[model samples]
Target: MRPTITGLGPLLDQIGADTGMTISTLGVLAAVPLVAWALFSPLAHDLSRRFGQPRVLLWSLVVLLAGTVVRSLPGPVVSLWIGTAVIGIGIAIINVLMPSVVKRDFAGHVPAVTALYTALLAGFGAISSGVVVPISHVELGGDPAGWRIALLVTGGILLPFAIAVWWWAHRGRRAHSRSASQHGRTGIWTDPLAWLVAAYMGLQASMFYMLVTWLAAISMSTGRSEVVAGVDVMVYQLFSLAGSLLLPLVLRGRIERFAPALIPSLAIVGAAGLMLAPGAILVWTPLLGLSSGATLGMSLTLMAQRARDHDAASALSGMSQSVGYVIAAMGPVVFGWLHSLTGGWTASLSLLLAVLVLLTVVGVFAGRDRYVLDSR
Candidate 1:
């Protein structure tokens, strides 16, 4: 998730200042990984089949290291773009393969392992977003490139994790084998239920991302100071962590059709709270955070649970994330455009409400106890 951290608010502005990149250019920089995820995600299944999941994971870490170095090295604008794209590509591979890895290694311990996985990703992101400003204040070699140093420090912290993954890959080289015959005839894309899963993933993610983009502004609208509004965002993240940690217990074995619907109801409740109470973000932020975290956990868990095996897990992960994320990436942009056009938050909130309804409808189908391989 260093890739996600690298694109945080403080880091984005610092990178733009260091490289003379405009806001529009910075938006593209931020979007690079999502686009790369959409493009490269499906390939992870093929790559894993050929080289093994562990090996592919190891190499993706290597790409992350290289891209992290190149990206935050106080380079030219072009290098920044290239490095960001490289980092995005690396994360995309890991993104698609990790849930599959959980399916293979912790088949019996799915909930616990999935919670740990999701928590760590979100945790790192929160730390990065909060620390980048402070990190920017620190001088590295007297370079004053605090943003650059901040990213490098984050990447360096990942070195131990990379080494561990590499060790795992080298040890497991011959334990893996590929068999195309194992895959069922149904591609993930053709399944109606799979689309519901994808829609659930995308809509929830889009709502989360869209809220993250404007949460502070929304807070400030109610007369909160910038500092307080920022704290509100952090509070949302903390409760989100709580949500992920707890939701898995609720979804340990088979899922009910209403499990997914439960998550969006949190969002809908929070939205209603905001509209009804106004300026009382303190009251509803936690519910919204829990909804975001729990919803994401459900989506990731479904990627593994719905699959018949690691191959199917990878395929489902690839299809859902690749397509789902591309859809999610448009959310903030759409909201911003709506805000600009309507000159208020009503239109955007209305859109958010509409998505919540759609997600609820889709989650009813996605949350059913059906397997992806059975779709055909």
Candidate 2:
């Protein structure tokens, strides 16, 4: 999802008659997944229950691949929008189910699993952004259609992972059945803790997407070259991966209460860096990445810890992701619109700082080691 969407960095200039649109406009297009994620969030569990997770996941990958492949085909702006929407739908399904899978399969290790998953995902994002231009320029026969080839590579890359997931599912059928039967009575949607989990997920996602869609542009406006700006974005994500990996290890035993306060503090620094010393963003970007990535993993970890059983975990994951995505989907569009109206990124940066403040306030409550039920 990150690669497919964030890869727009190089293409933004190429969009629409080789005429460049503002970063805000590009942000709107890049953020389409937010809408799809919100819409698909509620259905993740239903789809899993109806077809089984393995089948649902398998198909989601296929859909994801198809969406990217079709978008790569040369066409007009409308076709690009259609392709983007399709990719969003595919990614939304995958994102919702991936957490539930970890919750079920690695019952005792949500933090570790989420950390690793996010780290690798962030790494993939880094690679995608770095190579987007190269792939478009050198690979795929060097045609404008080359962009399609570059985009399609991600879908192809996912095939092996999808196949492995299929194999893993075949072997885990017995465990899946047992877990399903056990969680049959309690519904996750009715739980208050579930709402907290979802809200955290949405808010974190909103910040991440907002940055992903605009960070490069922000750098460019600050006088960085497109290459440097892209590299800066890649560095941000690499640090995000590192943060995701390190935080779970660092916070493992220290999170006795409100460990989530760390997220907001980090966000504050990031906001300040973006607005105050745009040149020093390279330093601040990693701090933001670390804080945000760690928070995301922690949020996922909380879902499993809070839920009483696998069913509750799945339900919570779905609810949180669904509602969270809806809230998140608006971040890019709103950020873009705000920027367009203000004529500079300062207002947008300020808006993001406000978001970070909210994150900190919520993190104080959400980060407590006590389970969601205890808070209630």
Error of 2 at 58 (Å): 0.9
Q: What are the per-residue Cα lDDT tens digits for candidate 2 across 1-62?
A: 56777676545555533435565667777777778878876777777777777777777777
Clashing pairs in 2: 72-148, 198-320, 258-367, 258-368
> Each prediction's Cα RMSD?
3.1, 2.9
Please, what is the TM-score per model? 0.86, 0.89
Q: Against the correct fold, how does model 1 do in TM-score?
A: 0.86
Candidate achieving the largest lDDT: 1
| Ten-residue stretch with the least lDDT total in model 1 | 2-11
RMSD of 1: 3.1
| lDDT score at residue 187, model 1, on the 0-100 scale | 67
Pairs of residues clashing in candidate 1: none
Model 2, residue 55: what's the lDDT? Answer: 76
The per-model lDDT (C-alpha) reads 0.73, 0.73
